[model samples]
Target: MRSGNPVLSDSTFLDLGSGAVLSRPADAMTLNGTIAKTGFLLFLTVLTAAFAWNQSISPAGPTAAAPIYMWGGVIGGLIVAFITIFKKQWSPVTAPLYALLEGFFLGAISAVFAHLYEGIVMQAVMLTFGTLFAMLFAYRSGMIKVTQKFRAGVVAATGGIMLIYLATIGLGFFGINIPYIHESGLIGIGFSLFVVVIAAMNLVLDFDLIETGVSHGAPKYMEWFGGFALLVTLIWLYVEFLRLLAKLQSRD
Candidate 1:
């Protein structure tokens, strides 16, 4: 199986040898288990996100301080995510922690966007979940098949996007900006639209990977891993939506 998610790659469900094999078939991964785990992680994310969101909106809260939570969430979540990726057995513990940390980051950043763009955050949230369910239905109904060509195309597009983002950030240090891609102009809006579409397509790849993992009878802990991977993609999609909406609003 293939996925554009860095965590849900082809080798993610590979058996590590005899030690990786589950003695009981019942202990193997299941689609239901992954759904349950994903729901739990989402709950954790929302719980912490509410806390940060509340802080951001507080009367005495300074927007400047929000970055503490934002950077903390971003850096800490990355660390935990890397640990979970390298040590799949630790996913059950790390996945929830990753969600919580990521919530801190997402909430702070989202609050900043909300402050600037009024109800843009809500619009982005609605669109994100809307796209998610729509994609899920499409995948389940076989409206979108996980063909090799499809997977390859999505992966290639994702890689290209990542490279462009890295280059943009790299140029930032030299006091240079990537025109059009970061502005509120037509080109910038078009770029964000393209990114949003690519990010949404990644969900299809993620779903395919989880279904494949369950079919392969991966370890139960893989459900946590799968859930974490999905969360990563969801977060990416939401953030991109926020950026796209913000750019569109800026044009007004």
Candidate 2:
């Protein structure tokens, strides 16, 4: 029931209620409802991403204002995401907003990567969705069970990666850079590959959490929260894939 995703955990459903049934469960959460909400949030993300993408590739090329969109999206998305995490009930309103804000960031970043490597953004997008669907199929087919050990391992690995990233950032302020982790050498490639695998494993955990939420008859609004969590993982996976690809391409 545990998940590497910070937004999802065994306590997620329990925190809503102890019973499998709710008193007014007429519109309780369902797997289908969560799926629909996920699609809608993705649509919102794509819609805004397209706008930012076009802006980045305009005839004038990346403008001085590009950083505005990038930082605005990053800071705004973080704030809204924290709000949704703490106030699950606000997910219905905050989730779509988060997606839209994230789109601004993703589009600008993707554009920058695309400029560096011609077709990298498309490759990353394809691989990201491919990994997502492949993991979903495996989860649905019982090929990958979310056993206690599996959850714990993924959670531990994810925490370790987060700490490494935090250390890198902290050290950055002192003008020191982590050597292999961000470089395009063999060690960096290996590190990126490991992170990609960990990010992919997280999808399986997210799938289990959504299924558990539905089976527990969680409140209808939880569908939005579940979808938001899924979107968060997807975004993370995509970004990791992009980084991995960039590293590989840099070697050329």
- Report the alpha-carbon TM-score of model 2 versus the true structure: 0.95
lDDT of 1: 0.89
Residues 1-252, model 1: lDDT tens digits: 588887877778766555443545787889999999999999999998888887766544437658888999999999999999999889999999999999999889888887788899899999999999999999999999989999999899999999999999899999999888899999999999999988888999999988887887888899999999999999999999999999999989
Worst 10 residues of 2 by lDDT: 14-23
User: All candidates: CA RMSD in angstroms?
Assistant: 1.7, 1.7
Q: Candidate 1, residue 181: CA error in Å?
A: 0.5
Clashing pairs in 2: none
Q: Where is model 1 poorest over a 10-residue stretch in terms of lDDT?
A: 15-24
Candidate 2: residue 16 Cα off by (Å): 3.4
Candidate 1, pairs of clashing residues:
none
For each candidate, what TM-score against the reference? Answer: 0.95, 0.95
